[model samples]
Target: MFERGTPGADRIDALRGWVGDGGGLLMVGGYLSFTGFEGKAAYRNTALHEVLPVELLPEDDRVELPAGGRASAVGTGHPALGGVTGEWPPLLGYNRVRPRPGAEVLATLGGDPLVAVAGYGAGRSAVFTSDCSPHWAPAAFCEQWDGYARVFGGLVEWLSQ
Candidate 1:
């Protein structure tokens, strides 16, 4: 959502201030999130990077899955994944990220984090390191997976709480 110059900087500062003041924030991955397709989603160079529960890669971090990929809820039984269990529907791909120390790793894809969360001041933040739609997420994930709503809904509810 950040553009150029002062406006983008303002948005970054505002988001930090808002989250620190008890607002909820969520970051979904894509060609414009974290380190995008060609490094266009350069949040690694922004202040928003610190508020996330995962460390952003300094370069393009997209993990392509031309043959598709799947994710699994971690063993922690986090409320954000309340009823989600077993293997997840196939995903076209996801962004690669490392979980920050003390942050909760709710789900994983291969050896990388698929979902992570952290407390930011009085508020909270979460990251879903994959797309919610086409390209990265296929219909099986966005339209057919029964846990989609529950997982995302639970995240929103958790952050809002």
Candidate 2:
């Protein structure tokens, strides 16, 4: 996952190669992800951007929702959303991203891509446009949300396939 800090060119190239050769990649969002705080993540110009399913905006894209935002599965049947049903706990915030052509939006929050997946050569990649824990996810989402395991586990399962 390419989060807060930018990886060196060599590392970025290697990661691109690995994904092209069937390695799975998952990018998680946070204050330090995709154009992070003040655009610190800086992945838009990196090789990692090539494999992502979303286009990173140039500026800081964090959106804070103190009252929380609703997250819902997009389609009727996406494996990544297996077992994940009903109203999800409100999220504190997420990074804004635009889905790329051929990418599948598995979930959304306020019409924004919350979870998305795409194929990268022989491998698969996914993006979770929100934190998996804390501030964004909130304690309820981490500890009490019944679909947590299904949501995350299904993502790994889909990527591995």
Off-target runs (Cα >4 Å) in candidate 1 are 1-9
Model 2 segments beyond 4 Å from truth? Answer: 1-9
Q: How big is the positional error of residue 91 in model 2, measured in Å on the Cα after superposition? A: 0.5
Per-residue CA lDDT of candidate 2, range 24-112, in tens?
Answer: 89899899888899999889879999999999999998988889998988753888776677888888999999999999998998788
TM-scores for all predictions: 0.92, 0.92
Pairs of colliding residues, candidate 2? none
User: How many Å off is the CA of 66 in candidate 1?
Assistant: 1.0
How does candidate 2 score on lDDT?
0.88
